[model samples]
Structures are given as C-alpha cells and as structure tokens.
Target chain A: MEEVLRRQIEKIVTLTDEEFRFVLTHFTARTVKKHQYVVQAGDPAPNDHFVVKGLLKSFYTDDLGKTHILQFAMEDWWISDPQAYHNKVNATLHIDCLEDTQLFFISIDNREKLCVELQKMEYFFMKKTTAGYIALQRRILSLMSQKAEERFNQFIQLYPTLLQRVPKALIASYLGISRETLSRMSAH
Target chain B: MEEVLRRQIEKIVTLTDEEFRFVLTHFTARTVKKHQYVVQAGDPAPNDHFVVKGLLKSFYTDDLGKTHILQFAMEDWWISDPQAYHNKVNATLHIDCLEDTQLFFISIDNREKLCVELQKMEYFFMKKTTAGYIALQRRILSLMSQKAEERFNQFIQLYPTLLQRVPKALIASYLGISRETLSRMSAH
Candidate 1:
C-alpha cells in the first residue's frame, strides 16, 4: 500500500527512501468496508484520501434530493470533499466506498507542513493540481457540449478502468445523463 | 499590469522588490481589442493571460455549431486553454476578449523556469491551481444539479460583476441554458 503511494509521487518527483519515510509519517492508513460513508454532506471533512486498494466515490445531493456523482477514485487516485477540506468548510458532498477499501488519509495541516519540509512534495502537488484542473476543464467541455454520446465516449477514453469498475447508473449520474440514455448509449 | 500581477501573487506568497522584478521578466504585456482571440480551437495555445483590464470568455464550440461558455474573466482574473498551455497540446477551446483588454501573458516554459528559479512561483501556481480545481468542482456540481434557477442564483452570487458587464446570452450559455429561460429567470 505504501509503495502504491510512493509510485504515484515518483511519477512526478523522485524521493529518497528516507524522504519517503518522512512523507509516510504525515499520512495514516485505514480500511473501509463496502457501503461505508467516509464523508457526509453538512459535516466536517478534514482530510483527503489516497486510494491504495478498491474503489470510492464522492457525490453531491442537491436540494431536490437527487444525487450527482462528482468523481470516483480507485488505486493510486485521490478523493476528498476538496472545497470542504481545503477551504475549512463543512462538506456539501458525501464520499463512500464502492468496494472494500484500503487508503491513506492526510489532513490539510499535515500536507502543508510536509510541503514546507519537502519542497519536492509541493511541486508534485502543484503538478497534480494543474493536471486535475485540466481534467475538470475537459469535463466541463463535455457537459456543455450537450451530446450524451460524445460525453460517454470521452469518459471511456479517459478512464477505461472506470468503465469496467463503476456501475452504469453512477456513470450516467456523473455524465449528467439518465440511466436509460446511458443504457442505450452503451448498447451502441 | 506588473503591479496587478504582483498583488495577485502577493495574496498567496509575499515577494521582495527584487523578487517581484525577476517575476515580471518572464511575462510579456499586450493590449487586445474587443473580439480578438488569444486562443482558438485546433491551434496551439502556449500562454496563460492575467487580465490587467477588461473582460474575456473561453468557450467550446460543439460539432453542431453551438457554443458553450466555459468561463469568463475580468480584471485580476486569469484565462487560457489550460490543457493546451500545460500539456503542450493544440487547443480544444477558443478564448476571446469580450472588451478591449490589457493583459500579461506567460508561456509554460517561462512558468516552469520561474518556478525552478524562484520556488515561491511554484507555490503560487499550486495554490492558484488548487483553488481553480475547487471552483471547477463547484461548477460541476451546479451543472449536475439539474435546476436552471439554482444555477443562475449561484452564478450571480459568485460573479455579480459579470451580470452587469456581460451580455445575457453569454451568461445563459455559461449556465448551459437557453436565452429565453435566462431572460425569464433574471426578470424575477
């Protein structure tokens, strides 16, 4: 599990064994069973989780009580109520395990301290955040494109792993399409 | 324009006089007339622009020839085809000036160089990117919320200045709604 994290960081910045050990000290590991909620709407969600194993999703439930999937993470990916965790606000989203999950979670304070201690981590995070921003931009483009078929195709191309792992209904929710539409699109 | 950038960066990381001067060296300032484009779909877009004055909008044009506004920036905001700028790819969106614009633009090479030479620049970019990611997440939630009225309310609260400066059709485009629907909603 630790090596999973090490490899993810190494993709951006190399770390010495001692430095890797130092980074590990800032994170705590835990396991969550399938169907467990990790972060809930209207609650304090103070940490970001890195998936070492299994699947998880974060979603928003709007005033009309309809749920919208924001994002999903599997091994080597990060998940959190980003606004809540970074801005120190109560969450407006809920995160739950889609499968039995093993993960490492880090608080924003510890992440900041680690960055100050290790500038390389800061660069890694900057690179990661920029990449994440680009991805969200892409998603916005797809949503605004208003072609459900184009969106489904783009999703599969970007996250082929997700297509195999996440349920069709959840994928529809994330794509902002109805399940019937997704079912028809998948058939094609 | 230089001071506009200085204040923007200083909001996150304070810099000395010499340091700020070094930062300015990497950027090139320019003035663009209204309706001019800084980036166009299918072209290579190499820089990110910080708006020192005026307004701009970045939008995606679909295959069916409809345009959807992805974002708008006024004075003190930044605009770019982020994926093209960061990933060195051809653009998939067009960014054009909504008003005669004065701006400072920086290439990715200079940006990376600035980060390497002055580590503070890296932190500044990271903080900006993370905040950007959070804002995009919020937008995604709004888009997926499936309530046009809620989306309009959220947009006004977040970018009240835009309502006065931008055309209603563009605002409707940004919110992924029809112009007639926006006119009706705004009347309330």
Candidate 2:
C-alpha cells in the first residue's frame, strides 16, 4: 500500500528513501468496508484520502434527495471534499467506499508542513493539483457542452476500466444523463 | 498593475521587492482591445494570463455552433485554457476581452523555472490552483443540481461586480439559463 503511494509520488518527483520515510510520517492509514462513509455532508473535512486499494466515490446529494456523482477514485487516485478540506468548512459532499478500501490520509496542515519541509513534495503537489484542476475543467465543459452520447463516449474513452467497475446508473448520474440514455449509448 | 500582481501573489506567499522584480521579468505585458482574443481554438496555448485590468471570458463552441461560457476573469484574476496550457495542447476554448484589457502572461517553461528557483512561488501557485479546483467543483455541483434561479442568485452573490460589467447574454450563458429566464430572475 505504501509502495503504491511511493510510486505515485515518484511519477512526478523522485524521492530518496529517507525523504519518502519523512513523507510517510505525516500520513495515517485506514481500512474501510464497502458502503462505509469516509466523509459525510455537513461534517468537518480535515483529511484528503489517497486510495491505496479498492474503489470509492464522492457525491453531492441535493435538497430533493437526488444524488449527483462528483467523482470516483480507484487505485492511486485521491479523494476529498476539497473545498471543505482547504477552507476548514463543513463538507457539502459525501465520500463512501464502493469496495472494501484501504487509504492513506493527510490533514491540510500536515500536507502544508510537508510541502514547506520538502520542496520536491511541494512541486509534486503543485503538478498533481494542476492536473486535477485541468480534469475538473474538462468535466465542466463536457457537462455544459456535450450531448449525452458524446459525454458517454468521452467517459468510456477516458476511463475504459471504470465502465466495468462503476454501476451504469452511477455513471449516468455522473454524466447528468438518464440511465435509459446511458443504456442506449452503451449499446451502440 | 505590477502592484496588483504583487498583491495577488503576496496573498498566498510573501515576496521581497527583488524577488517580485525577478518574477516580473518572466512575464510579458500586453494590452488587448474589447472583442480581441487572447486565445482561440486550434492554437497552441503557451501562456496563462493574469488580468491586471479589465474583464475577459473563456468559452467553448460546440459542434452545433452553440457557445457555452466557462468562466469570466476580471482584475486580479487568472484565466487560461487549463487543459491546453498545462498539457501543452491546442486550445479548445476562446478567451476574449470584454473590456480593454491589460495582462501579464507567463509561459509554462518560465513558470516552471520560477517555481524551481523560488519555492514560495511554487507554493503560491499550488494554493491558487487548489482554490481553482474548489471553485470548479462548486460550478459542477451548481450545473448538476441547482435550478436556474438558484444558479443565477449564487452567481450574483459571488460576483456582484460582474453582473454590472458583463453583458446579460453572456451572464445567462454562464449560468446555463435562457436570457428570458435571467431577465425574469433579475426583475424579481
């Protein structure tokens, strides 16, 4: 599990074993069963979780009780109520394990302290955050401009493995499309 | 204009006079007239612009010729095609001035070099990018779940100055509301 995190960091900036050990000290690990909530709406969000194994999702539940999928995290992906974590506010979204999950989590203060201690870690985080920013922008564009079919195709192309992992209804919710529309598109 | 840029950076990380001057050396200043594009689809996005004065918008045009406004940037804000600028791809969005605009722009290479030379700048950028990621997430939730009236009200509350500065049609497009719906909401 630690090796998975080491490799993810190494992809951006190489770290010495000593440096990696230092980085490891700032994080704590947890295991969660399927359907366990890691974050719940209206609760303070202090940590950002980096998936060591298994699947999880973060979603927003509207006042009408409609669940809108915000994101899915698999191996090596990070998940958090970013606004809540960064701003020290209550979460507006909830994150739950879709499969039995293992995660390494770091609080915002510890993450900042690590960045200040290690310039390489700061660089790694900046690159990761920038990439995340780009991905979110693309999702926004897809939601605003793409039709249902186009969005489904784009999603499939972008995450071929997710189709098998995530339920079709959840994917439809993520795409802001009806499950029937996703079924028709997937059939094609 | 330089002071505005300095103030924005200082909000995240403090910089000495000499360091700020060194930072300014990496950027090139430009003035653009209203309706002039800083970026256009199909062109390589090499620079991210920091608005020193005036307003601009970034939008995508779908295949059917429908335009969707992605964001509006005013003084003290940064705007770019994040995917294109970060990934070094051709622009998919067009950013044009809504008023006579002055900007200081930095290319990816120069920005990376600055980060390497000054860890403070890297930290500053990481904070900015994270805030951007949070704002984009909020926008996604609004698009997925909010009614047009709610979205418009959120927009007005978040950016009161923009309602007066940007044209009504663009604001409607940004809110994903019809112009008539916006009119009705505004009248109320």
Candidate 3:
C-alpha cells in the first residue's frame, strides 16, 4: 500500500523513502460510497484527496437546477476545490463519488506543513498545479474553438472513466452543449 | 517601478529583496505597440510576459474564421499560452496587445532556472498558478451553467479592465453569445 503511494508521488517528483514516509504520515485513508458527497457547494472545501480507486467528480448546480461538471478524477488523480481549500473560503463546487472510492485525504494545514517539512513535496505540488493550470487553459481554448462533437470526443479520449460513469445529459451539460445536440452527435 | 512589481509578487508570496532581484534579473523588459501580435496560432509560444502597463488579449480563430477570446490581461497580470510556453509546443492561440504595453518577458528556461535559484520565487509561482487554476475552473463552471447575459455581467464584474478595452463582439464570442445579444445586454 505504501509502495503504491510512493510510486504515485514518484510520478510527480522524485522523493527518498524517508521524505515520502514523512509526507504520508499526515494523510488519513478514507472510503467513500458511491453517490456520497465528498464535498458540497457553499461549504468550505477540504484539502486534496489522492484517489486510490473509483471515481469522483467536482461539479456545481446552477440556479436553474442544472448540474455542470467542472472536473472528474479517477484512480491516481487528485480532486479538490482549490480556491476553497487553499483560501479557506466556502466551496462553490460539489465533489461526489461516482463509485465506491478509496482516497488518501490531507488537510490544508497538514499539506502546508508537509510542504514546509519536505522540499520534494513542495516541488511536486508546484509542478502538479502548473500542469493543471496548463490543462485548464487549453480546455478553455478548445471549448472556444471546437464543436460540441469534437469536445465530446476529446473528453472520451482523455477521460474514458468519466464518459462511462456519467450520464450523457450531464456530459452534454459539462461540454456546454444541449442534451439533444449531444444525442444527435452521438447518433452519428 | 520595482516597487510595484515587488508589491504584485508580495500579494501572492513573500520574497526577500535579494530573491526578488535574483528572479527579476532573468526577465527581459520589452515594449509592445498597440494592435501588435505578441504571439500567434501555429507559432511557438516563447515569452511569458508580466504586464507592466496597457492591455492584451489571448484568442483563437475557429474554422469559420470567427475569433473567440480566451482571456484578457492588463497591468500586473501574467499572460502566456501556458501549454506552449511550458511544454515548448507550437501555440494554437494568439496573443495581441490592445494598447501600447510594457512587459517583463521570461522564457521557460529562465523561469526554470529562476525557480531553482530562488525558492521564494517557486512558492510565489506555485500560489499564483493555484489561484489561476481555481479561477479557470470557476469560469468553466460559469460557462457550463450560466446564460450569456449572466456570464457577461460576471465577466464585467471580474475583469472590468478587459470589458473596457476589448471589443463587444470579442466579449460576446468569449461568452459564446451573439454580438447582437451582447449589445442588447450591455445597453440594458
């Protein structure tokens, strides 16, 4: 179990066993049932969760009672409402478990402490955040230029687990396309 | 001049004068004229600019030859085609100056070296990137759920500088709305 987590951390940045162990001590293992709310809109977002298995999605419900997906996390992916978690503000998004999930959860305080205590951890998180920012920026560009079908296809290619677990309507909404449009595109 | 830049960096993370000077040295200052292209689609994104004054917009032209705005940057904001800048990929977005602008430009190589040479700079960038990610996620959520009018209002509230400088048609495209609708909404 520890080795698996170590490998995951290694993928981001190199860390000696001692540093990894030190960082791991602060996180607690969490099990979430399918449909369980890892987070809720309007509540303060907790620290990041490192997924070991299953799936989770960060989303929000609109004034019109529509759900819009912000991000989907599967095994080995991390999920959190970054603003709420980092700034200790009320979350503007909800994170829900799409499957029975196992995650390693760290608090904001603990994560900061880890960063201070382990330079490698700080470097890892910094790289991860940079990569995440790049991905989000590109996605915005794609949304601006690509058709709904193109976006849907890219979504499936990039995150197949989300496509499988999430309903088509929700996916359409996430893609900023109407359900009818998504359906029509899928039929083709 | 340095004081303003120092304050901007301080808002994100604390940096000693020595560290600040060290990181600042890696940046090369340049002036941009109004309506000039900083970078264009299909070209390599080189310099990530720290805007000292004036305005710029990052956008993409779709297959239909319609330009869609992605982001607008004004004084004190950092602007770049993140993917192309970070990964050294050919850019698919174009960045153009809306006004005569002063910027401190840093290449990715220099950025990496700065991070290594100055720990405080790394922390500052990490925090800034995290904040940027959170903002982008919120924007994506808004795009998914909100109507064009609501988005336009939010956009104006959040980025008044952009609303003031960028054309209404580009803002309409940014909100994925028709130019006529933007005019109607803004007139109200």
Candidate 4:
C-alpha cells in the first residue's frame, strides 16, 4: 500500500524516506464493500480518501433526482468534495465504492497538522488540485463544444481501463447524457 | 508594494524579512496599458502575474466567436492561464488588462528555482493554488446550478469594487449572459 502511494506522491514531489514515513503514519486504512457509500450528500465529509485498490465515484443528485457523477477515483487517486472537505461542512455530494475498496483516509485536521510537519506534502496536494482544476476547465469547455458521442469517445480514450470497470449507465449520467443515448451511441 | 505582498504571503505561509527579500528579487514589475493583452490565445504564456493595481480578465473565444470569461483579477490577486502557464503550451485563452495596471511577474522556471532556495515559498504557492482551485470549482457549480441573476448578484457581492471598475460587456460574458440581458438586469 505504501509502495503504491509512494509512487503516486513521487510523480508530484520527491520526499525523503523519513518524511514519507512520517506522512504515512497519519493515514488510517479502511476497507469498503462494493456499492457502499463512504460519504453521502448532506453528511459531513470526514476525510479525503486515497484509493489503494478498487474504484470509487463522487456524485451529486440534482433537483430532478438525477445523479450526476462529478468524479471517479481508481487506484492511487484521491477522492473528496474539495470545498466540503476543506470547510468541514455538510457534503453536497456522495462518494461510493464501485468495487470492494481499500483506501487511506486522511481527515482535514490530520492534513493541517501534516502540512505543519512535512511541507513538501503540501506540494503533492497542490499539484493534484491544480491538475484536477485544469482537467475540469477543459472538460467544461468540451461539454460546451462537443457532441455527446464525441465526449464519450474522449472519456473512453482518457480512461479506457476504468471504462470497462464502470457501468455504461453511470458513465452516461456522468457525461450528462441519458442512458438510452449512451446505448445508441455505443452501438454505432 | 512589498508590504502588501508580504501580508498576502503571510496569509498562506510566513516568510522572514530576508526570505521575502529573496523572493522580491526574482519578480519583475510590469505596467500594462489599458486595453492591452497581457497573454493572448495561441501564444505560450510566460509568467503568472500578481496584480499590484488595476484589473485584468482571462477569457476564451469559441468557434462561434462567443467569449467565455473564465476569471477576473484585481489588486492583490494572481492571474494566469493555468494550462498554458503550467504546461508551457500555447494558450487557448486570452488575458487582457481592463485598466492601466501594475503587476509582479514570476516565470515558472524562476519559481521552481526559488522553491529549492525557499521551500516555504513553495508552500505559499501551494495554498494559493488550492484556494484558487476550490474557488473555481464553486464558480463552475454556480454556473451549473444558479440562474444568471443570482450569479450576477453573487459576482457583485464578492467584487463590489471590481463591478464598478469593469465594463458591462465583460461582466455579461463572465456571467454567461447577453449584454442586453445584463443591461436589463442592472437597470432593474
């Protein structure tokens, strides 16, 4: 588990062995069953879960009761509602395990304390957030510019492995398209 | 100017007088004329500009010639095209000065070099980028959930001083509304 996470962190910032060990001690491992909700909308977000194994998705239900998937986290990814997690407010989204999952949970309090000790860890998070923001901005622009089929093709291209793992219906919802539309498009 | 910047830096991470001076040497002060483009679409972005005075905007023009205003920066704010600035790629967005402006420019290369000297400076930037990402996520959610009037009102509430300084057309574009609609709403 430390090996996988260490590799992920190395991509963002290099840490000394001592610093990595200090950072690792704070995270608590938690196992979640498939389809289990780790967090739900309106509940307080306790931690930013780092995926060690399996898959998770964070989503929100709109006024019409339509589930809009905001993010999908596979191995080595971090999943949380950033605003809710930072502020410790009632979450406006839900995170659920799509497969039986192993995760490292780091709470906001722990994150703040960790940043105090290991400043380089902050760099790891900042790089992740910046990368996420850039991707989101491009995703929004694509949603505005591209057709549904084109968006789906792009999504498949970007996360080909995850595409086979997640259901098409959920993927369609995430893409802001009807499941029927997704089926029709996939058939072509 | 240094005093104000010091306070801003302290909001993220504390810097000693000597450390702050070290950072100051790396930044070049620039003055932008009104209506001048600081970073244009298709040009590689050179630096992240920190506003000392005046206003600037970053926007994207789509194939249909509709401009999507992504962000507006005022005094004490940092502005850049994230993808272009971070990846050193040709920008898909343009940044223009709304008024005659004074700014401190820091190249990405210089910033990385400085981080080796002052790790705390890196922590400062990390927090700033995280805050920016969180704010941008909220803005995107507002675009998804709120009506034009609500977004306009929220924009006004957040940047009352900027509302007075920037033109109606840019504000309309920022709110994703027609200029006529913004005029009507403002009149009412």
Model 3 error, position A93 (Å): 1.3
CAPRI-style grade of the A/B interface in model 3: medium
Ranked by lDDT, the better of candidates 2 and 3 is: 2
After best superposition, candidate 4 residue B44: deviation in angstroms? 2.1
State residue B70's C-alpha deviation in candidate 3, in Å: 0.7
Model 3's alpha-carbon lDDT is 0.84
Candidate 1: tens digits of C-alpha lDDT, residues B1-188: 68889999999999999999999999999999999999999999999999999999999888889888999999989999999999999999999999999999999999999998998888898888888999998888878886898899988998899999999999999999999999999998
lDDT of 2 by residue, A68-171 (tens): 99999999999999999999999999999999999999999999899889989888888889989989988988888888999999999999989999999999
Return the lDDT, model 2, position A166.
94
Alpha-carbon deviation at B143 in model 2, angstroms: 0.1
CA shift of B186, model 4, Å: 3.2
Angstrom error of the Cα, residue A9, model 2: value is 0.8
Query: Which ranges of candidate 3 are over 4 A from the true structure?
Result: none
DockQ, per model, reads 0.85, 0.89, 0.74, 0.43
Winner by lDDT:
2
Kindly indicate the candidate among 1 and 3 with the higher lDDT: 1
- What candidate 4 gets wrong by more than 4 Å, as runs, is A14-19, A62-66, A144-149, A178-181
Candidate 3 backbone collisions, by pair: none
Estimate, for each residue in B1-188, the C-alpha lDDT of model 2 and write its tens digit. 78989999999889889999999999999999999999999999899999999999999999999999999999999999988898999999999999999999999989999988988888888889999999999999999999999999999899999999999999999988899999988997
Least well predicted 10-residue stretch by lDDT in candidate 3 chain A: A1-10
Candidate with best DockQ: 2
Please write out the lDDT profile of model 1 over residues A73-178, one tens digit for every residue.
9999999999999899999999999999999999999998999899999988888888889888888877888588889998898899999999999999999999
Lowest summed lDDT across 10 adjacent residues in model 4 chain B is found at B137-146
Backbone clashes in model 2, listed as residue pairs: none
